[model samples]
Target: MLKFDHVSKVYKGGKKAVNDLNLEFNKGEFIVFIGPSGCGKTTTMKMINRLIEPSEGTIYINNEDIMKKDPVKLRREIGYVIQQIGLFPHMTIQENISLVLKLLKWPEEKRKARAKELLSLVDMTPDYLDRYPHELSGGQQQRIGVLRALAADQPLILMDEPFGALDPITRDSLQDEFKKLQKKLGKTIVFVTHDMDEALKLADKIVILRGGQLVQCGTPDEILREPANEFVEEFIGKERLVQAKPNITTVEQIMNPRPITIMSGQSLTEAITLMKQHRVDSLLVVDENHVLEGYIDVETIDQNRKKARLVGDVILPDTFAVEKNALVRDTIRQILKKGMKYVPVTDENNRLVGIVTRTSLVDIVYDSIWGDEAAAE
Candidate 1:
């Protein structure tokens, strides 16, 4: 429940970091600010907590102007997280997490309870309560930082790249955990990150900025499906644009559901016949359980037809395979690099699901970028 009216921030050197930004963050919605470096996304968020004052205009929280309120009192009502994971070295994990609660004059027992509760939310055991900041790993420390912000159950939270420092796997896991926590709590959150994928995944609404100016604001799907202009399109990047296209985000979305397959012990003649009937050059080879074993092409079959009677004798182990849930952009890159006509798609258990062909990818891209023009013609 925050609103910005004609907000602009100009520094001492007459440089504007934010230009006439007018926005409203709805209650219980996750809003993300995204753009390149020097785009003032951080500046925009900082202004909310009064860490950075705006040069002009007003910021309001629940119909009250923030500037008119005491900065310290205003900030106490809001939760804040930054990239640095700023935990005091001298404070124990429990103390650090309960810092905000303590400041609010919460009693010792309640603060301790809040600390334990927050730790459990992040999957940390209560034993961590006695540990210091240095005792935890980087990811653990960041988790504590997030917990600290939520320690007092503030109605609004501001996070500025809170997971940027962690490894990809850890960051991804935290993102999921944070999303769940946000939904469970229903707190209004303003998040700022340069990563488009993170914004697309997390934000209910995405606000794009460039050179300190509002470029576009909309839902992730809306922006992806229809960028405001060339700058907006380029900012979203080609890979994400592809992901935003209708029914083309993942390998499973484009994979041939019933790709021709032959059992391991099938005869070479049968493999050739299956290939001919399917009008394809290659056939996937599988075990009785339909688990992918390898593949055999017409050339391989022809070369070994005389000596190898069974398809298994000629099938070459599949070198390139992608999970069905993987991004289509990654599958496209592998296909292009390996000069493959199609790549095998497998389930999480490695059972063959289907195949993703180059043709499928090209068709999706074409329709996304130029399908409207072709339709007009």
Candidate 2:
């Protein structure tokens, strides 16, 4: 939906912000521009909405040169989000969100409805509508900022480090939520961030830059498997390559299949017997269809052994079940951080498919850095 044809941006002092960039952003795709400080990620993004004008070359949206369009009219047709959120403190949440719609002369009822609909998309409710920016938390305020961008329903959206200011947990949560929202809405988004993990997690295509030049542009898997050069490899970090491998490695690739399990209806005695036979401290508890319910461990059994006759009575909620298609490195990092012994691997339907343990992670690391033969040895 957007194209950059030999685009270059040089400041008045002759510092190049972007150097002969040639790229295309497809419709309904989440494209991320990521790099270190002074890498021109923000510059390239700003040029999309004319916040920064290009020094040379043409930018096209659906084959029409953007230079031909008036800046105000062009901006109104495209959504722009920034790191600061830029919400008006005096305005209510509803008014903040509906500002763009109101500018476009949308009916009052329509604007109000859009605000409510957008809030609902982010799991916020009508109760938040009358509240001011200060009334909400940082994360909530950022959500409102995103809602404001989507309120006008523009086909093309440009986000410049939209989640950069939030804490790590909130940033990750927002990234996941925004990714889902993008897929559902099918809007073409050009997102900028310096964080490589964010790009790996959220981008359909990643464009890596350095020194105001394009370093590599490809799918996360493609870049992970084969970086364009030493600079690209270094930027991705050797540790990230070993641990998370981005889109290239998945839990399914290393997970142990046919993990020992106990049915929810199983007796505590049976659960104890199973654990002893398997020499495991815990056994995954599953329904008849093998859907993961939770788990029962020796500790839980010992605590409730006399009080609980059934395993279900002592079953502890499953806290960590890695998705089968999740990146092995990312999954391993989470598991190790939480000090978990193992994690169940579940399919899209939440059916238990396999398991991953520290031992399995060792095998994966060995196989990743070395060869299968070396791992076997």
**Candidate 1 residue pairs that clash:** none
Worst 10 residues of 2 by lDDT: 239-248
* Candidate 2 global CA lDDT score: 0.89
Q: Which stretches of candidate 2 lie over 4 Å from their true place?
A: 243-248, 336-339, 372-377
lDDT of 1: 0.89
TM-score of candidate 1 relative to the true fold:
0.73
TM-score against native, each model: 0.73, 0.92
| Candidate 1: tens digits of C-alpha lDDT, residues 230-333 | 99999888877865666567888888888899998989888888888889999888898889999889998778877999987888994578899987755675
68-102: candidate 2 lDDT, tens digit per residue: 99999999989888999899999999999999999
The Cα local distance difference test for each model comes to 0.89, 0.89
Scored by TM-score, the top model is 2
Show pairs that collide, candidate 2.
Answer: 243-329
Q: Which ten residues in a row have the lowest lDDT in candidate 1?
A: 329-338
